[model samples]
Each structure stands twice: as structure tokens, then as C-alpha cells.
Target: MSAPISDISGEHKVYLRFLGKARHFLFNLRSFNLTPAEPIPAAATKAVEVSVALGCAVNGTAQPSDIAAAVKMASQADVALVFVGVDQAIGAEGHDRSHIGLPGVQSDLIKAVLAANPRTVLVISSNAPVAINWEQENVPAIVGGIFAGQEQGHAIADVLFGDYNPAGKITTTWYASVDDLPHFHDYDVRKGRTYMYYQGKPLYPFGHGLSYTTFEYANLEVTASALKPQKAVGIALSITNTGRIAGDEIVQFYVHVNGSKVQRPIKQLVDFARVHLEPGETKTVSFALGHDDQALKYWDEAQQDFVQEPGKIDILVGASSADIRLKGAVNLMV
Candidate 1:
């Protein structure tokens, strides 16, 4: 067995101190938890003895060499958890990465470690997706964690230990390759962008997530001969969890307009909701369709904002963008 390692380092202590002060000013709440965990595995313990790493590598404290050494140590360990991700490169608001690959020498380090020890369970900590070139066949499990809240570390540990079931879904598409994307840069622009306008396919479509528990949908209802301007319609369905574990389900609503005056997307996501359900539990999920959501919003060259056009519309409710479980039709009068 390896000797016990210090929970917090001298450097981390200073950072935590500053964080404590900042929290006091921001929330008027000074009680904060910044305790660190003891290092496991002798190799990891030794690596920490050499350098007191910080939260992010961009601050010039944790260098490439430090990360490489840590990866090397982790690869040799017989641990069930292997956390790998960018500390600051991908998650920052204005810090969009040029490539989806892991930053700096992190990718290379991961490749080397996996090649040496193929059985290690990989947990990818990232707000956005990253590319993994290795054969996933060797890896049994892959967990993608969004920038979880302040209890992220503890929450992840609990999930791994089966203390909590993962019910979250991916709101954005996860492309197999950046090349597989449809003009990623322009996808967010006002003129014909986003998954609705994109032509190509994504690896994982929007509203994609796996639950330990399974669910079934039935009894779809839609009321409206025509979707009139400024009018609302009703849609309802029954959802039940079939698996043993309790989980949350997210119901997504999409609209496909027909015979439009202007160009429109193949399907547009108008509304979504997440519900918690126990095993064998059944509940009815309902959504009210508003005129603004059903109507087509287009940017007129002469005018500004989005203008709604009168046309026929089809309402779709389903698990994902590609999977429309139920469908209904409505016509909008000008």
C-alpha cells in the first residue's frame, strides 16, 4: 500500500483562500467546501510530491511535463476511475477551441497510457465533445460529464459507484468528426443555421442521453384542424419507465412546416421538458403549442427580427431529432 498523500497542496491552499474571499463578495455566503482528496496509487502520490498542480494548466503553474507524468502514473495503477479532460481550453465562454481533439500533449498522453493499459475505465470530463482516435472496443465504458456544479467531483464518484443513476441527455449533437459537421462556424448565425438548417448528419443527434432505466411512450393526442396565428393548441402523451432504476426523461417537441411562404428548416425544436419517474411509474406529458413556436421565423432583408408566415404545420414529439415517436398536423391561418 502507498503512503497517504496530503489532501491540499501549498499552491492550492492559496487559490482556495482567494476563492473563499471571492465567494463572500459574490453571494454573501462564506461557507464553502474546498477540501481535497487523498491521492491513491503510489505512482500518483509520487507525482504530486513533485508538483502542486493548479486548477488549470493555462496559468503557467501545471506544465505539459507535469500532466504527462501524472498520466504515466495513472496508467500503471489498478484503479477503476480514469478522469481525463481539458482544464480550461474547452469550457470557457469565449474560449472556443480550434480543434475538437484534446489540447496540448493530453491526447498523446491518453493514447500512450491506453496502449499500455487497455482495461482502464475512461471518464471524459468536458463541457464539449472531444475526439478519441483509439479503438473503443478495448474500452468497456465511456462517460461524458458536462461541467457539473460545485459538487462535480463527489457527484461523479457517486455515479461511478452506482449511488446515482445518470439521467442527463446531450442537448447538442456529438459529431464523429469535425468534418462530419455542417459548417460549424456558421451554424449559430441568424440566417439559416443550427441543426434545423444543417444538411449533414451528426454522430449523436440532439436530445440524446442514456438512462439506466428504460421508458415507453403511448397515447398521443393533438387537437387543432389548423394552427391559427396567435392561437394555442394542446398535445399530450403517456410515458412510463420500464427499468429497475429511477430516472428522468426529457420530452422534445419539434415542428415541420409545410407549404411555407419562405424557406424553413426540416424540423425545428420548439419545446422540451424533463421529468423524474420511478421504476414502473407512468405519467402523462403534455405541451401547449404557441403561435410563435409553430410559425416560421425568417429574417427579412428589408425588415429586422424574425417574421412569422402563414402555412401548414406538423407537430412531432419524440426522443430525439431523428426519432419522432408521435406526429400530428395543423394548418396556420394568416
Candidate 2:
């Protein structure tokens, strides 16, 4: 065993199970001295093993006329759930794409489907960014299903129904169009590469996720009025579920320090917490920060060290970057 079975084995009681063992007759294949005339090639054996591990039972595609047929069926229903996006043919390694939209006739299919059924809910499967300004403006709902392997269908269905409350936050900034992105040939990052430097309006900002229920934030406080370079700072706030159902509210804490010695981001995320509360239930959340998070650090080439600046650090807290509901500040002294 590479790391010993003790390091990885689990001991779970299966409904008060009993332990039993059976001894089998030992057979040595060498004693028979039997061999195949032609042994299977190593590549064929590897391919079979790999295919067995990955399996062939994932979501499959429809035929040429299947999309229109699906749209016709969806037109009669109250809600149309449309699953569209790229597959390994266009999104996998060595498969560089020419555009940032849906692959093949998918864009045309989307328009046709929407014309037939306006209440279409689009589930997009992609590893990279794609333009969805039209869908964002017209569609009732859209879910990003980023290459979630085989069981992504279950997750999509659960979110569509009320079985699971969607609370996942996006990590990357998505542009409204491929034109909004800088050319791949341009190495300059100031053209808006990510959430930290992007100045253009995005369809969905970073740290954005829709939930079934709503939340209210109030009672924001800080543990200290002033902070020292070597010391830590703490923040506290309360979140209440205002809607009629129980859901999770991800409370994020961001810090902005002006008068810094170096160029800084507009706001930096320092900490966050996910609190699940029932209707009218309020929960208090707290976060503590170390030196790096409490102050703006700059490289001191003269001393060959990173130095923290003493200044006022503005603390912003809320459900997301755009929805900050609380604000406070603390002075950092040497």
C-alpha cells in the first residue's frame, strides 16, 4: 500500500452489520502453465480501464430536428427548460474556439426556442466565459453549469425546482460580449482582465448568486477603534432572513484602505460567512483579520521587506460586492 490502508480506510457500521469471512481454494495459474497465444496490447488494456472509469452514460445530444421538436413541446408547457452550450469538441484542450458564444447552430436554436416559448430557463455548460446579454435581458432565469461532470443534471433540476436553494457565488467576472474582452495578443492587463481591474459593466459581477429567499443586514460593529501594524482587527454583523423561506446568506467583508504607499484594488475581500436562517431569524456573524488583511502591505526594497502602512481602513460588509449593506472604519497606528 502506498500510504497504508489505515490512512484511508473508513469504519462505518452498516445498520448494525455482522462481520463474516470465507476461505477459498487457492489456485496457482503458473502450475497450469497455460498462456494465451497473443497477449493483449498494453494500450488496449489502458484504454478499456480508462473508459470504464469515465463511463459512457453522460448527457447526450439530440438529432438535427430534435431542438425544434423540443421547442414545440416546450411551447405548450408553462415553463421551458433549455440546456445549451459547448461540449468537448469545442471546449476541451487543444480545441481553441473562434468565438465566445454557444457552439454550432445553438445560437440559432436559442432564438427559435425563445420565440416558441418565452419562459425559457437556460442552463449553460461551459468552462470559459460566454456572452449572455440577450438572455439576461429577456430570459426569466439562467444557470451556469460549468462542466459539472455527469451528475450536473441533478443539480440543475434541483435548482429549477425548490428542492435546493441556489447560493453559489461566481469566482470570475463575465463580460457582456467577446468584443468587451481585450485581444489575446495584447499582454497588457490594464484592459480589464478580472474583477480586480475590470472597469466595464459585466452582466453578472463577481460574487453574485440568486437565492430563493431574501435577507436583511443590520447591527454592524467593529471590535476595535484602532489597530496596530502587528495586531489584528475584528468585525461583527447580524443577518436576518426577510423572506418567507429558510435560505443561506453569504455575508462578505471587504476592506478599502486609502493613502496607501502602493496601487491597490478598489476593494479587497478580507473575510465572509454563510449563515442559513429561517424566516425572521437573525444570526450574528464575526470575522477576525491578521496583519496582511488589516493593513496595506508594500515592498520596501531599501530594507528588503514588506512593510504595512498605518492608515484608516474602511470596512464594508454585505451579501455581495454590489450589495454592501454595512460600513465602518478603523485607524491603524504604528
Per-model TM against the reference: 0.71, 0.74
Per-residue lDDT tens digits for candidate 1, residues 200-240, read: 66555777776778888888888777767778888889899
Q: Compared with the true structure, what per-residue lDDT tens digits does model 2 show for residues 23-101? A: 2211112221222234556766452110001111112334656665766766777776666665555554565667776
Checking candidate 1 for backbone clashes, the offending pairs are 226-331, 227-331
Name the best candidate (by TM-score).
Answer: 2
Off by over 4 Å in 1: 1-79, 89-96, 108-119, 133-138, 181-193, 303-305
**Global lDDT of each candidate:** 0.65, 0.69
